[model samples]
Target chain A: MSPDRPTLTATPHNVGVDAAVAAARRVVTALLHAGDGSAAAMAEVASRLTAVAEHLEEHAPTRDERLVDMWAGEGVTRHDPVTGPENAVAPPLPLSGLPDGSIQGTVTLGLPYQGPPGCVHGGVSALLLDHTLGVANHWAGDSGMTGTLTLRYHRPTPLFEELTVRARQVSVEGRKIRTTGEILAGDAVCVSAEGLFVNKHLPRPR
Target chain B: MSPDRPTLTATPHNVGVDAAVAAARRVVTALLHAGDGSAAAMAEVASRLTAVAEHLEEHAPTRDERLVDMWAGEGVTRHDPVTGPENAVAPPLPLSGLPDGSIQGTVTLGLPYQGPPGCVHGGVSALLLDHTLGVANHWAGDSGMTGTLTLRYHRPTPLFEELTVRARQVSVEGRKIRTTGEILAGDAVCVSAEGLFVNKHLPRPR
Candidate 1:
């Protein structure tokens, strides 16, 4: 079977909800594309996208179990071209007993990220680092927005390789969470970053 | 004379050198357009552009005088269409013998910066903040590389406004200079930023 083929678990019926969520996502994506791309319009688009993503998560099969099974499945042994192949094979985070100050994930850079001949863009590198660091801050029990980020490029990160990003909390003072991370290409450190994430009261969902 | 017209500035004895530099810039621009845009390539292009800029400064008769002059002559008023007309007509730095903590300059934002319909791109805002913060750091007697930068967008910054950016030194610890700035559209603060700049010893050209 192709990797794209969905394997329904032995659970009770949820196909109607899943299909509805998928259809909603398609409609939202289309609406966002049709918008004039203004700030107000994009803000609305982002809101709609967030709502669709949340609904999809609620209606879909157990994400962790499905991801683990997919990892072991032959159809998903390799990376997927879209939604990211490396990301598709990524091991799901076990929510049972989460750690205090560590986060780990793997991502594959694709053709959409060509900055140099075959290397990733610096800005893209910054984006990934910021995201992983933010996750780490959240995991460390200090959920916050990125207040500051400092990146040092040791060398060019080659595309198509499975990059491992790990972040850990250094300390937390007042509302700021200090964290550091490194992107490793195999055993070599391709980029290093230090960031200060500031905790802010999240707006209540309307 | 049209503001875009390139006038003879005291008639440099070697006009051939200026022509050669212009030709080189054209060739470089063409080569950049042909290559896979990478961070390394962008850095290389930035370096080459800096070289051309420095060459022009060296050959221009009133370049040094204009550097200190608050109101520069019309020679430096032409807008570069590539980077956008926002960069055109950069005002000269007015370095009066006051204290060591003064930040001042005026820049125009134009249509080329339309990332979100009528607003500037987020990255472009960061770039402008970085550049302004770099100058502020230099003025504060701590010329250094950006160690960390944090920006908070309170509201979307509109394009084609005479935005005023003001930076002030919050504190200094050892070699790190901490400063904060805000981009004001009219009386409202559109974006606020804080940055940590580090001073590293480097060989200066004679």
Candidate 2:
């Protein structure tokens, strides 16, 4: 007889994954409807995609009951709902699929993340850069917490648009990883960032 | 013979030495009033200080304009205001005299910096760490833009109370500064931070 199995907790305890997916779908759809397809619009889209990713992280399974492994084993690759854009900005592929030294992702933004009247919050922009640069460090095989991130906002990132972010490892010395990236609305870069991420020397899971 | 006097432009430009001084005064005053001399209070105070700093940066001067030699010769330190609690926290300094390489400040909280009803925003806590660490870095003579700030929030930093942030420089490299700091409510450390700040290699003034 099998030993008493630990009860499994269902995901989506917060607003329910379906609700989050629906909200994200609504935002993406609105962006598609606007159809400006400008670089600014793309950056906005990237922001929205980040929110969806955040929601998924909030609802996903936890590892070890203490920390949620944000970059661990992935379950969903992409979710294309009916309300999503016809050519909806595809969800970012998992880091697991990427080559050992590269990181890339796309996202969309909407109203909920707005800080200024119609622009993304500066803090939110910093968050995006931190996560993206962190991923770059991880891809370069140097996993660490963010030590510092410097953002230069060349232009105000507009809301409700699709954006692309690409992070590339610059160099690594001991426990510190240096990387740089930019958030592109389309071809226009709205925000650029460079960072130093320091590996904390935590034990890797077996 | 009289020396030819340069006529001053009177078009109400935003970037000027007087404007910077005014902005600094406003920021310093807001920071002083915002703190209630407690760790939790410092969280809220840091948020208000960030808003004030951002406003000052936005209106008072551009980074390039700030780099002008005339201003540099004036013996003014164009310190960037604390942006947020994640990477920096500047608590209100009560006493005029403190030893070099020390972090000293107090603050109070209000509804304006609230994240969830009565609690201070998590990001606000991070902002506090950033500012406090930056100050520590400044004291250590390794002043630079925050390259990375890491914050571990052990508990919810509360809202509306006197709080203190004590920080000190740990070590320094050629261009990298290392510092450790904590936000305390009486005896308990609410949040702790370790930061790496890269020195700004400004060109020598002509």
Candidate 3:
């Protein structure tokens, strides 16, 4: 069985579609930190979430086969969840094009992404870097799968604060694309990464 | 305000409590890849999930504020969406003590944790490493927050497969614990990581 359970493999949509996904993400975020003060509250919360799950199960595609890897084409971690629009979790990093062949993005992670008390989760830092580096490779005309990613977390990345990330392709060798980038809060560089992405050999369709 | 959303401080629970959290995580894993085949299905799923959200919101404790890092003491990341049980995302990697004072864990990533087609998200791999390294540091009696986590994705870490992770503290400075670990599928070393965990200087109780 494909690791990717069957998803509604829909193409990313317009603003209207994105907004709805964003709203769902907001709720998910809220739940991420919704602390329990009472047992009754916890049970009620679980039941409700479960009902939602049940409902999804009911309406879900009753399929014998599943669609595989539809990595959100516009996936920008801290912005979208894989479960959000086009199977992307909402609030996607709305990265924009840069004339200089690099990509820039901004996002504010919340409770859901926390690792330390007030810092964004370390793996999350790398997620942003990996995605950005992949995009960087794409812009450089070398889109591929990540063969290796190396990261350095210099300082704690704070949550609920806007962070800036920039990436550019450094060099290319055969099927490998080397790229580097950094995450910043105002002037502090919190995390930096270099990734080696390899272009997948596509099966030529007859 | 501290970026870590204010949470209700609570201690970890016992096996029974952990079992319940584990159950919740299972449901979440189902939802993560719950494919919506129709708009009506999506709405129904939304409504059910919303009921769950509403129950939590209404019964949730409205209080002054508190910050805590549960770290899956009761965390079930895949199910609880990172908030339900002790501040964790469900389908969490539950690591625990061994007689030898080392820590070991196992987990399976589904659709939501995918990156690069059939593989686990790179950042997720790093997250597991960071957590395991911290656990190892704790076992070595040198527990601390992460100072720097460096990871090398030797190859694509597969999903929905049981992956074993092991960590150990290699050395320690006055306030730093240097650790290393790997995620494996049987015999293949998919990812390797080393981290520097730093002891946080806690504020002296007045």
Candidate 4:
């Protein structure tokens, strides 16, 4: 249970340009984990990066593009961060639907996804489970936006080890869809998530 | 309510190298969001970045340096991706403990933190709340790793907007500590999280 309160701040200040930018972002993420500790060398690299940033800011779009705004980045089409086939950010889950309507996928997180020493970052586990639950909703024919996500870490999800994920639609009531999923490293279950998604009839950007 | 399944995974893979690498990651995250779609120009930048990565991997640390594994790298000392003063991965919550043993902080997430089109990533919200709840436990003299985190999203936490967060220790049940917190965008409550932390007596790397 949570406190019923109001805490409205402000709307988004800037909108992202297009989906292509996220692709570039995935690349940047790969490079960041791969840097040396030379101050002079890094300074030189920073200057170049700054120049690129300034140019984009100068010419960046003012209006938001309705392109997919997901970690998977127009998933199943081009490269993406979460589920892309060629990108380093992906756990690269190749999913197949079971006969029971539940979805199952396999992935292996590497050093790039670490947060707690050798274990996978807790958020990364949430991210993967969220996406998996969303996929469950999509299979249910109610592809909707995530209204809420709840997660419990039974144990640390490991990296560099092949893991299996399974998600199923628990229920679909009106616009609200509920789904549950669990992550497993072999037979051992590590993380579980429950997500609520709302399918909007009104026009909303993807 | 969860399966009392006894399926635990293997231990973590490895600890991160050093604090300096996180600083460099912050740079990479920024540069990725800044690219303006010049493939030729980015390719050139990529080449230089590749060289830097190769050099660092060759000279990376072989032993633990006791550096913080958090975005607060070398914490309160150097810049990092999650809790740094000048990093995009951080919400930069400036927190203080209240009279009743609660902690409060204010944060405004800009670009590089978006999950949905205009809303803050649910995982990001969880990340901020998880850290805040842990900070509250620290104030109460019982800091521990997250065992379970349950969150409910009442409304979308917007990006690029100022939000207020508060956390308080609720109860201590043996080794388990339960805490609750909420995030508000002004007055509208966007997200709420309940965390369970258990301070282990065994030696664990930072």
Top-lDDT candidate index: 3
Better of 2 and 4 by lDDT: 4
User: How many clashes does each candidate structure show, in the order listed?
Assistant: 5, 54, 24, 12
lDDT of 1 by residue, A117-165 (tens): 3454443455456555655665567856555667665666876688877
Interface root-mean-square deviation, each candidate? 21.2, 18.5, 5.0, 6.7
Instruction: Give one digit per residue, the lDDT tens place, for model 1 in B1-206.
Output: 23332221112111233223223222222221122211123233334334433433333433223222312243321111111111111111121112436564334454323223345444345555655565566556675655566767666677556777666667788988887777778889876777776766322112
Q: Show where candidate 1 strays beyond 4 Å.
A: A1-100, B1-206
Rank the models by TM-score, top first. Answer: 3, 4, 2, 1
DockQ of each: 0.03, 0.03, 0.28, 0.18
| Candidate-wise lDDT, in order | 0.44, 0.44, 0.58, 0.57
Candidate 1 chain A least-lDDT 10 residues: A88-97
Clashes of 2: 54
lDDT of 4 by residue, A1-206 (tens): 11221111111112232232333333333333433332224444445445544554444333243123222243332223345432223444555566677877777765545555656667667767877787677666776777777788788787668899888999989888989999999999998988888886223354
Per-model TM-score on C-alpha atoms: 0.37, 0.37, 0.77, 0.71
RMSD to native for every prediction?
Answer: 18.3, 16.9, 8.0, 10.8
DockQ of 3: 0.28
lDDT (Cα, tens digit) per residue for candidate 4, span B40-60: 244444454455445444443
Q: Positional deviation of B199 in candidate 2, in angstroms?
A: 24
Q: In terms of docking quality, how is candidate 1 classified?
A: incorrect
The all-Cα superposition gives candidate 2 an RMSD in Å to the true structure of 16.9
Could you give candidate 2's per-residue lDDT for residues B55-147 as a string of tens digits? Answer: 333333332332242224432122222321111111222211144537556666433233322444444455556556655665556776555
